[model samples]
Target: MFKKPTTVNRMSQPEDFKNAFVVGTANVQSDGKLKWKIVAIFPNAGSLRQHGNILVVAGPGGGKGRIITVNLISWGHSAIVIDLKGETYTKTANARYKVDNGKGKVVVLDSKNGTGHRYNPLSVVSRDQWFDLAAELISVTNGDPFWSSVANDLWLAAWSAAQHARRPHMPYAVELMKLDLSDAICYFMYYHKDDPATMQHLLDFLGTRPNEEQMAKIKGGNASRLLESMWKTVKTTMTIFNDTILLNLMSGHDVDVEGMFYNGGITTIYVIVDETKPRVFAAFGRLIMKTLGDALIREGDKQNVVRRPILMLFDEFGRVRLNDVFDWLDTLRSRDIVLCIFLQKLSQFAPKNGKEFDESDENSFHHWILFAPNNPSGRIGKLISGMSGQTTVRADGGVGRSVNMDGDITTSRNVSFARRAVVEQEDYETWGADQAYVTLRQLRTEKYVVTSANTDNLGWALPPEAQPLPRLSSYVSPLMPLPSEIDAATWTAAQQIVEEAGGDDAVSNAMRAALGGLGMAVTV
Candidate 1:
C-alpha cells in the first residue's frame, strides 16, 4: 500500500477553520449557519418585542390554554382572558401564584348568566365612551328607525338620570338629548331597514313634522309597515330606565369599585351569560366590548400618556356581534389597547344576508392564527389558506410502451411507463423494478402552526398531557424582588463609601484606593 503523506499533529482541523470564517466585516460565523449564529437564540426567553401583536388559533383539545398560561409565566406580562366553556385553568403547574401575584388581588369576571355577572355600560366607561359604544350597538341593528328611536330615548333618559345624580360627565347626557332626530333617524334607517328612501323620509319627517296627509303617504309606502313595527319596538324598549343602583350592579361593584378605573390596577369585569341561550349573551358581550374600547380611547386622549395596555381577550368571539371590532382593531393599537379574539372558524364571521365580505378594511387585524381545521375545504380552510400564503402544484403524464432487441435476432418487448410516477423512476428502480409501482399522489391533511406574534408562544407540541410544563412564573415576581435590585445594591455601596469620606480630600483618595483593591468603586 502507498504510504500516506507524513501528517503533522495540529491543535485544530479544517472544519474548525470553516466554522470561524467571516462572511463580511464584523460578521463572524461561530456556528454552521451565519444567520442562525447572529440570531439571538435564548432557549427560554418568553417576551416578544413590542412592534406587533400575536394570535393563537387551535382546535378543541389542541392545548391553546396551556400554551397561553406558560407564555404568561415566562414573559412577566398581564392578560385578560374571557374564559368560556367553563374550563378552569387551575390544573397547570403553579397556577395559584400566577393568579394571585401576592397583592391580595386576583380578579376573575365570571360572565356566565345566573352567576350574577352583568355589565352595565354606564359604570365602566365615561359618558363619551358610553355614547360611542351605544352608537356601535345601534349601528349593528342597521339603524332600524325603531331601534334608533329607542336608543335615542334611552340615552336621553340615562343622561337625565346621571345629571340628577350629580355625575361629573353630565354634558354627555345633554348632548344626547341635543342630537337631532333627523340624524338619529338617518343612522338607524340606513343600517336596520336598508333603505335610503326610508332614511330620507325619516329625515324629512324630523325636519318638518309631517302632516296627516304626508304621514298617510309614508304609511302607504313599501317600507311603511316595517318602519311602523320598528318604531313600536324601539319605543317599548327605550322606556326602560337606569338608576344609580342599576349602574352599580352592572359594574360588579359598589360606588368604591368605580373609582378603581381612575386608580391603576388590572380590573377584570365579566359580563357572563349562558352560551346555550345565545340571544342575551350575544347582546351583552357586544355591549361590553364596545364599551371597553370606547373607554380606553377616551382615557388615552385625556391622560396624554399611554401608561397602560388594556388587553381584551374574547374567547368564543364567533358568538358576539363583530361589526365595530374591525374598526377598533385598526385604531386600538395606537391607543395602547389590544384586542385578542379567539374564534373557532372563519365561517362564523361571514355576513348573514348575502353581503360582500370586506377583508381590506383598515380596522381588520394584521395577524391571525390557524389551528387544525375540522373541514379542510370549507370557508374556514379558504380563509386560512388566504392568510397563510399557500400555493398549489400539479403534474401530468401517461403510461407508454418500450421495446428492446437482444442477440442476433431482433425481439419486440413491452415495458410499462407512468404518466406521473408516484416515485421518481430512479428511486423506483433502486427498490427493484419487479416490485409494483405507484404514481400520482397528492397530500392533503390539516395541521396547526403559530400565525401571529401576540400568540406565537401558545398551543401544544402534542396533546395537553404530553406537553412539558411552562417554567416562566418561577423566575420573578412583580410584588416581590425588583429586577434591578443587584444594580441598586452596587450603587448603594458606592454611595456609602462617599459618605464615609466626610469631605476630607486625603481620606477620600485613600477610600478610593481601598475600594479599588476590593474590586469596587467610589465616585466623588
Candidate 2:
C-alpha cells in the first residue's frame, strides 16, 4: 500500500540542497546551476616509453656523445663499445666502473699504430654463420659478376673443410684464408696471376700437405720466393697485420667466453673502428657483425642463453661496404639482434656512374636515426622520409566570390575570396640506381625528435679541418696480441735459423731451419 507524504516542520530550515553541495569557491544555486572560476587546463604527459634499441644520429660535435652519456647514466643497461675513434670516450672516463655501469669496455682496433688484434669467430658462432659473412663480402665485391660464383664456391669448400675437420663452431673459413691463397697475401711483395689454377694450388697447399711433385712445382714457381719474402713483407706492411689482428679479435677465445660478450650494463654499443683503414675496417666490421648474428642465433637454439639482446651500432656505416648487413638485420630481429646503422648521406649508398649497386633485399633496417640531411629533396632524403612516415603538404587557390554594388551609380563592387586547398602530397619514386624499401609494416612506432638548444654543440662529427676527408676513423682494439709485434718477435727468433743453415746444403738446411724457427718440426 502507498502511504501519503506528511510534511514535518523541523528547525533545520529544509536543509538547503544548494548549501549542501557548495564549497569554499563554488556553489550550486537554487536554480540547480553550478558555477566556478576557471583556473588552468593541463594535458596528460603521455606514457613513459622504452625501446629495445636507440640510434643517435648527429654530425660530428653535435651533442650525440652528451645525449648518449646522459641516457646511459639514466638507464642501467649493458653496452659493448667498438671505440672507432680512440678519442670519443677517453680512457679516463672509461676507467670508471659506474660510467657505463661497468659494461662499457672499449675494443680499440687501431690500424695506424700497428697494434690491432684478432679473435676466433668459431669460438662464438656456428660454421654456417661464418660462411654467410664470407659470402656477403664476396657478393658485395662481385655483385652479379662471375666472380661471385667463384667466391661462393670457395666459401662452400671452406665450409665443407670446417665441418669435416670437426670445427663447425670455429672460424676455420677465415683461418683458411690466412694460409695465403696467392703471393698477393704478402701485398706488394709479389703478384700471382688471377687464375683458377693458381688459386686452387694455394688452397691445396693450405688444406693438405703437398706431395714431392707439388712441392717441386711450388718451389720452382713464385711460391718459394713468396715463402722466403713473407717475413720481410709482413714487417714492412704493419697495416695488413693490424687488419688480421682485428679479424682475430672477433674470433672468440676457446676458454673465456664471457670475456668476449662485452657485457657492460649499458644499452648502447659504439664499435669505434673509426681509426682503421676504410676498406679493411669495413671487411672486418661485416665479418664481426655477421659472426655476432650467427652466434646469437646459435645461442638462442641452446637451452639457456646467457647474453642479452645486443645493438650493433655501425657509425659511418656506408664506408664499410657492408651492404649485405641489411639481410642479416632483416632476419636477426626475431633473435633479438638489433642493428643501429649510421651513414653520412643516403646518396653515398648509390652505385657510381657505370657501376651497379646490389639491390638484393634492400630496405633491411627497421628503424633509421637521421640527422642534418644534406639534400632534403634528394632521392635518398625522400626515400628516408617516406620510410619514416613523414608527410609534406602543398596548398593552392581553390574558390572565389563576387558581389553586386547596392548604392553607388558609377561604382560597381566586386568581392573575391582567396581559397587555399591541398594540391598534392609527394610519395617516394623508385629508380634503377636507388635501393628500394621492400619491408614496410603498419604499426604505430615511436620516434623522438631530438634537437639541441645550443647551435655550437660539439658531437660525433669530425672537427672543421677534417671535414673534407674521404673516410672517418673506426679504429678499435683487437682481442689478440698485435700481429706486427708477433711477426717481429718471430723474425728475431729466426736469426738462429740463418746461423744453423750455414752448412753443406744451405738451401735444405735453411728450409729445415726456417721450419723449426716457425715452431714446426720436420721429419727426415
Candidate 3:
C-alpha cells in the first residue's frame, strides 16, 4: 500500500478536457462519498483533440486493479480485460452482467481455470483468411525463406482439408499436419478432383494425372520437400494445442462477439489466460484482438448502430509482444476500439531483451498514467520531469545602490520571474506510493493525483466470487493426435496387399496402399 504525503499534491491546472476519460477517484473521507479525482491537466492551455487510449505504467500489487479498473467497470465502459488471475472478472462480472437489470452479458474465456464459455477460434475466421491464420500459428524462422513458404503451403493445404473435414480447430489441424504429406495431397487430388469448390491453384501446384493438364508433379518431389518443413509448425502447434483445458475452452462457438457486443447487450469480455506462457497464450490473445475488430467492422457495415465506444483493458500489456502491440496501436482506434494498456515498467515493454521495442513504441498511446515512482536521475524520472513542462514563478526584487561610469550613484530594483517545471524530477524520485503522474499528451501538460491505496472504500460494489455464469456441458475435449490420417478401410486394404507382398515394412506395398493411393493402385 502507498502512503500519501502530508502536503497536498501540486500540479498543472487541467484544461481542454473534452471527452475526458476518467483516470482516478477521490480518496474516501469520513463522509464516504465517492467523487471523481479530476486533477488539473493543462489547466492553462487548450487542445483540439485527445484520444481515448490510455497507457497505465505501474508495478505489481499496486492499485491499478482497485483504482483504475474498478472505477472503469463502475463507470460502465465496454471492455475486453485480459484478467491474468481471473480476479478482475470474479470481482466485476456480476455487476457487469446485471447492468441494465439483467440485459447485460459477460463473456469469460477462462481456459486456465477451465471454467468459462467455449469458443472455436477457427469458426470466426473465413476460408480466405486461412493463409493469414497459418502465418499467426506458425513462427517462421529468419534463416530460410523457401522453407517458410513451403511450411505455409503445407499449412494452407492441411487447414483447408481440416475445414473440409468439419473439424477446423487447431487440434484437428495439428492432427491433419501429422499425416504423410502425399496422403493429404492424394485427398485433394483424387478424393476431391471432381469437386468444384476446392482450391484449383493448389491442385495445379500439386500436379494431376498424365491425361489432364500437366501440373507440377508433387507426388514424390513436392511431398518430400514439404514434409520436413512441417517439423517446426507441428511441434509448435502440438505444444500449444496439447492442453486439454485449452481444447475444452475452444470447443465450440460460444463466444459470439458480434451478437454480444457489436449488436447485442454484452459489453465486457474477460479472457483468463495462462500468464506463465505468454508466447503460447499470445496466440489466443492475438486472436481475440483481431476477431473483435473484425466483428465490429463487419457489423458496422450492415446497421452502423453503435451507441457506446468500445474499450479493451489489457491488464498484462507487457506480457504481449510489442510488435503485436504496435500493429494494434495503429489499427483499432479508427474503429472506436480504445486500448487501456496496463504495464509494470518501461523495460517490460521490450520483453524480448529490447529487440521488439524502440523509442517509437512509447508514442503509440494517447495518454500515459504512471504509478511507479522513479529515481530522480533515472531515465523515467527525467522523462517525467520534462513532461511536467515549465511554469512561470515570480521573484520579488529589492532596491539596491549602483554606480554609473559618470560616478553618479543610483538605486535600481526590478521584479523578475522564470519558468520552472510544474513537477520536478526530484519530486518523482521521492513521491509516495499513492501518487501517480498523469500525462495528457494532447494537452501538453503533466498532472498528478494520489490514488486510493486499497479497494476497501470503492464506490461501486464488487461482484461476489460466488456469481455463476451459464456454461455448456459438451466442449471440445482433448484427444491424442491420431497415429495417421488413413481410415480403417484403407488400412485394411493396405495390410492385405502388403501381407500379400510378404509383409515388407520398408515403404512396403502395405504402407503405400495404406497411404490410400499415392500413385495408381488396384481397386479391391
Candidate 4:
C-alpha cells in the first residue's frame, strides 16, 4: 500500500553541467539509437577540488587502474607513484608523457640499490620534531599506553643524541640497541666541552636515565631497562637497516619535500621497489606518507595562499603493511592531499580480528570506482552491494496442474518476490576489463568504458613505443648530504677502497672497523 518515490533527475542533460571533466564514455541509448556517451568523472572542478580523494579497486591486469591513473596524469595533476613492478608509470622514456602535462616536473627517487635520488626521512622537519619522526619510522602505535611511552622515550633519547652530534638523522638500528649510557654521556661532554651552555643542555636531556634509587622504587630495574626492551621491539618490527642500501639511503636527506609539494610545479616522486624486496617497499611507503604529510602540515602553517592539489597513486596498497595509513586517510583529505589507494578486494582492508576495516574512515572517501571483481559473493561484492543501495523487485511465475475430480480441470498458482540489490554479485563478476562502476554521493551511478583521451577518434591505439616523451619543466638534482669531516680526499680514498673490495658492503665494514680500531685516538 506504499508507493515507491519517483526517480528525479536534476540535470536536463549532461551538457547542462558545464565544465564537467570527462573520465570516460559509457554505452547509452539516445534518440532511439545506441551510442557511446561522454560521462563526467566529476561533476565539475569544484567537486573534484572538494572531494579529490579516490579509492580504486581492481584485480591483476584489470586495465581500469592504468586507464584511471593515466587519465589523471594527462589532466595535468601532480602525482607520486609507488612503482611496484617498475613498469606501470615510469618504465619507458615515453611513459613520462602520461605525467608530463606542462603543469609540473617529474622526479624519480630510485631506492632499488641506491641508483636514484636520495630521501632523508629526517630532513623535512626540524630537530625538535625528530622524536616523533623516529617513533613513526619504528611503526609505534598508541594501543598500549605504557609500551608507547617507553618506546617514545627510547627513540627520543637516541634521536636527540644523533641530532646534537649532527650525525645521520636515521642511524643504524643496531646502534640504537647497543647505545652505551656512559659512552653517550662521554660523547656529549667531549663534543661540547668548550661551550658550557651547550653542555648543560645535553646533560639535562641525558639525565632522564633513572639512577639507582629510582630503579629500586620500581619492579623493573629502571628507565634504561625499559628502553632496552623497547629497542628489542623496534628492532624486530623493522629490518631495512640490515641492508646497507636501505640504511645508506635513509641516513641521508635526498628528496626535497618542499619542492615536491609547494613548488607550484608538477613534482613526481617515483618509488621503485623490487618484488623480492617487499620489506624495502613497506619502509619506503611509510616514509613517503609520513614525509609528505608532515611537510604539507608545516607548509600550511607557513604559507599565505590556499594549498594546491596533489595526487598520489599506490599501485598495490595491500602488499605493504601501512599501519598508519588509516590515520593519513582521515587527516590528509582536509590538507588538499589526494590519495588513490589501489587494492584488489575489500577483504584486504578488513581487520585481522574484526568484521570492519582497520580504520573507521575506510569509507570516508567521497568518490569510489570499482572495476569488475573476480568474486562478487566475496567481501568486495557484499560491500559494493551495500553501497549501491536496494530497489523494489517484482518476480511473477505461473504453475498449472490438472484436477482428478473434474477430468478436464486446470489449476494455476502465482509466486511473487520483491526487494533486490541494484547490482547483484553476478553483475560484478561479469564486468569487462575496461569497464568500471563510478558512484558519487549526490550523483546518479554511472558505468564507464575507460579509454585513452583521443583513442576513439584516432581509430588506432598508440603503443608505448609510439608515445612521445614528456618535456621537463625543470632539472632535479640528486645531491645528498655527506659527513662534514670526511673531506674530499677521504671520500675519494673510500671510493677506491670500495672499488678494490668489489662490493659496497665490504667497504662499509672496513670503514666501521677502521673507526673502531682508532678507539679514543681520533678526533674531528
Candidate 5:
C-alpha cells in the first residue's frame, strides 16, 4: 500500500524552492500539482536568504550539461563556476551577461594559460590572516611533525614579511620563502621593528628566545640536512604557483570578492582549468573559499535578505579541492553561500589520500540528485533503493481449477501483498535517457520520475571581455642593522659594550633599540 502524503509529497514543497535548480518537473500527478524529485533546500521565511549545499551525481549522457551548466543561466545569483575546459563559459557566458537585469559582471580567471582576468588572491589579505594563508599554502602531509612544524614557521615568517612589506603576492612569498634564514630574520625584524608581537614571532621562528639564549640550542640555519629536506618539500608544494603564468596571474588584484556579492548586481566568475595542472586549482579554490566564506558568514549574520546568494557551481568538482571543504560546508549553513558539486559518481568524491570515507561526507549536501545510473545495482542504486519506502503489491494465485456449481469453472486463489522497493535495483540501471532520481535529506523523500531535462532558458552568449594584466609591483623596508649591515668596527664596539654589561644578549637587539631611536631598521 502507498502512503500518499508521506511518500509522495505535495508539489507545493518544490514551489517553495522556486529559485533552486529544477531536478525534474513531472511526477505522478495528484491534487492539481505535479509530484517530482527536485534537489532543493527550503529555509524558513526568516532564513529566506540561505540555501543548503548540493550534490549531483550523473553519469555519461545523463544530461550533466543541461542540468548543471545549461541551467546555470537561471541561477540569478553570484556564482563562481569551475569550468574544466573553456566550454562552460563559452556556452553560458552570453546568458550570464544578461542576468541581473543585464548588469551582471562576468569575469574569467584562467591562470594556467593566462587568459581572461587575473586574480591576486592575497590582494585583500589582512595582517592577522597571514598565518592562516601561510598554513593553507603549505599543507600538512604524512611526514615528520618536526619538519612540518619548521616549514609552517618558515611560511609564517616569509608571509608576514611579504604582507607587511606590501607585496602580498604568491611570487613574492615564493621569493621570500627561498631566502636564507638570516636574510629572512633581518627582513622580518626590520619591517616589524615597531611591532613587538611580530618581532617575537620572528625570534621564535628563528628557534631562539633572547632571555634564555644558549649557544648549543641554536638550530636556525638552512645548512642543516633536516632543514634542507623541509625546504625541498615546501618548494615542491609551492611549485603549484612558482611558474611565470601562474605567478603573473596571482601577482595582483583585479577581482573584488566582497563587492561582487554586495555590488547590487549579480557577478558570475568562471575559473578555467587545464586538466594537467589541477593542483593549481587548489590554490584558487582555497583563496575563494576563505575570502567568500568570510564575507558571506559576516553578511549572513546581519540577516541582509536583500543580498543575493553566492552559488559556487563546481562541475567535475571531485577533481579539485576547496580549502577545509567540510568545515566550509558547516559554516555555510544559513549563510547565502551555496555550492553545487557535480561528479560522474559518488565514488569519485571519496578521498584520494587513503582516508576512509564516512557517511557524514555524503550528509554534507542537503540534496542529492541521481540521473540514469550506469549501474543501478551499485552503491548509488542500493542507496536509492534503501532510501525509498517499500510498497505492498496484491497478487492472486490458485493451486488448481475446479468446476463448482452449474458447470462453471472457478478456482479459489491465495492472495498475498508482498513488500517491494519503490525503485528496484535493476530498474534504474536500465533507465532511459529521460529518467532521473532525486532525494532531499530534510524531507527524507525520494522520487523516480521522467525528468523534463529542461534547458530552454539557455541562450546566446557574448564574447568574454579581455582584461589587461595588472602592473608589476614590489615593496621593501630598509635593511636592518644586522651584523652583516653594520661596519666591522661598530659591530666589534657594540659586542664589547654588550660583554661589559655582564650579560650575553646578542648585540643585534641593542643595535635595533639604538636604531629604533634613530628611526633605522634592526634585526633580531
Candidate 6:
C-alpha cells in the first residue's frame, strides 16, 4: 500500500562486526539523526545481534538474495552455505570473509569436482551420534510404508553394530550396506550376550536360532525374504555412499562442526552437488543439515554456551527436507545456531513429504524476507499473506446528483466506500520483477525495493584465493591405513600377521576377507 523508504542513511561499523562491513544505508532526518529499517545484521546498536536467525524467500535473479549473503559474510559470521550454483559464496563471500580481521576461514567442499575438504558424514560425528544419524537417513522415505519400516530397522541394526565395533575411524558405507542380516544378528548375539534383553530383541526380530542355525535359516526361511526386502529399501539410500567421490569425502573426519564454530572461527562448508546426480546430492544435503544441526546442539550443551553464532545459509534449501528441521529451529538458538533458509517457494520445504509446516516452525524464525511471489495467488504468497494478515482499502468513490424543483435546484450526494486487502491478492499474481516484502519479529511485515551492496566494499571476485582443505586426497590409497583401522590392542595380532607379509595387497585382502567372515562383506 505504501512505497518503500527511499531516503538513504549511512551507518558506522559496529565493534563486534568486521571493519567496513556495511549492510545497507538507512535514512537520516533533517535534525541530523539517522533512522534505520532493519538493514545490517548486527547494526551499530547491540540488540539486533541477539536475534540472528532469518529466513529469505527469493526467486532467481532477485538481487535481494545476494545482498543477504554478502552482509552475513561481511559481518564475518561463521557459516555453512549450500550453494547450488557455486557462484555467490565461493567467489564473493568467501573472499570477503577471509580478508576480515576476525578469526574466520573459508573452506569449499566441491562434491562434483572433488576439489575441497573431505567431510565424511558418517565419520564427522562421535559414536553417540550414530543412532541419530541413522534416523536422519531413514527419514527421507519414498512414500512406501512397509518397506520403509523394514529399512529403518535394518539401518538401526547396522548402525548400532558400527558404533559397537569402535574402529579407528567410522565404518564405510559399503561396510554398513553389505552387512548380511544373519551376520548382524550373530554379532549382536555374541557382543550383547551379557545384555540378555538386547539379545532377546534381536532374536525376536530376526526370528532365527542364536548360533550356527541362524545363518542357515536367514538364507532359506521367511527371514530370507524379510532381509531381501530390507536391502531393497536401503539400496537406494546407499547411492550417495556407493559413489567413489562421495565416499572419499564422507570417509574421513576432515570437517569438524564443533571445532569450526567453537572459538569464533568462521568455517565455510560448501557442499557442491553434481547436477547429474540429483538423488545422490539430495541425500548428502539432507545428511549434512541434520548432522550439523545435531552436532551444534550437543556442542552447545557441552560448553553451556556457543562461542560464536553459526549460520547455515542454504540456497535452494528446499532441495532436502531436514528430518528434524522443526525441532532444530525451535531449540538451536540456545546454542547460538542461526538458520537462514533460502528457497524459491515455501511448498518446497514439505514437497511430497506429506508434512505441513506448523505454527512452531513459523514462530521459530526471527525474520522473513519474502520476495515478490512468481504468482499472486501462488501457495507461497497465500501462506505468507495469511501470516502477515489482510489489509482493508477503499474500493469505490462517492457520487453526486442534482435535482430541480418548483423554484430552486436541490443537490444531493451519495458516497460509497469499499474495502479490500491492503496487499491485494493480485499484487502477488503480477509481482514486480524487483520488489520484495520483509517481515521482522516486531514489525511483522513491510515492503522493500531490493538493493545490492557496494561492490567496492566487498572483497575479491570469482575463484577466491584460498587454500585447499587439509585432508588425505584418497582413502582408497594403498599407502594409507585401511579405512577399518581400529585400536592398537585389537590389531596387535593382525598387525603382526600383516607385518610378516611381504606386500600390503595380500594383507589388505586378508583383512577385508576377515570382515566378510564376520558378515560385513566390505569391498575395499
Residue 203, candidate 6: Cα error in Å is 5.9
- Ranking 4 against 5 by TM-score, winner: 5
Q: Residue 445 in model 1: shift from native, Å?
A: 36
* lDDT score for candidate 4 against the true structure: 0.45
- Per-residue lDDT of 145 in model 1: 51
RMSD to true structure for each model, in Å: 27.6, 20.6, 12.8, 13.4, 11.9, 13.7
Top candidate (lDDT): 5
lDDT, each prediction: 0.36, 0.35, 0.48, 0.45, 0.50, 0.47
Local error of candidate 5 at residue 38 (angstroms): 8.9
- TM-score of candidate 3 to 2 decimals: 0.66
Task: Write down the TM-score of every candidate.
Answer: 0.47, 0.44, 0.66, 0.59, 0.65, 0.61
Off by over 4 Å in 1: 1-51, 67-75, 88-101, 111-119, 138-147, 166-232, 235-248, 251-263, 266-271, 302-306, 350-363, 374-376, 384-524
TM-score of 5: 0.65
List, residue by residue over 3-43, the lDDT tens digit for candidate 5. 23342121122223334333333333335533332232333
The residue pairs found clashing in candidate 5 are 94-461
lDDT of candidate 3 at residue 333, scale 0 to 100? 60
Q: Sort by lDDT, best first: what order? A: 5, 3, 6, 4, 1, 2
Clashing pairs in 4: 104-266, 105-266, 118-254, 119-255, 120-254
What is candidate 2's CA lDDT for residue 351?
38
Query: What lDDT tens digits, residue by residue, belong to model 1 across residues 236-311?
Result: 3322222222222243332223222344443433333456646545645665566656666666556544244445
- For 1-524, candidate 4 gives per-residue lDDT tens digits of 10222222111121322333434332323354222222224333334445556666556654444444434433444567777755544432223333344334445555564555556666677667655665665644435434444445545544554555566645533354343433432333344344443343333332233335534544465442433343355455445645555555565564556654556455666677767877767667666767767776676455576445666777776676555565566466666667777777555663433455623444445444444333445554454343312221111000111111211111111211211112222332232102222322111221113332232222222244533422222222222222224434433443443344334443234333443443343323
TM-score, model 6 to reference: 0.61
lDDT of 1 at 188: 32
Q: What residue runs in model 6 are displaced by over 4 Å at the alpha carbon?
A: 1-22, 25-52, 93-103, 123-128, 139-150, 160-171, 179-233, 303-306, 351-361, 373-375, 380-465, 468-472, 475-524
Off by over 4 Å in 5: 1-51, 124-129, 180-198, 208-233, 303-305, 350-358, 390-459, 463-524
Candidate 4 vs 5: which has more lDDT: 5
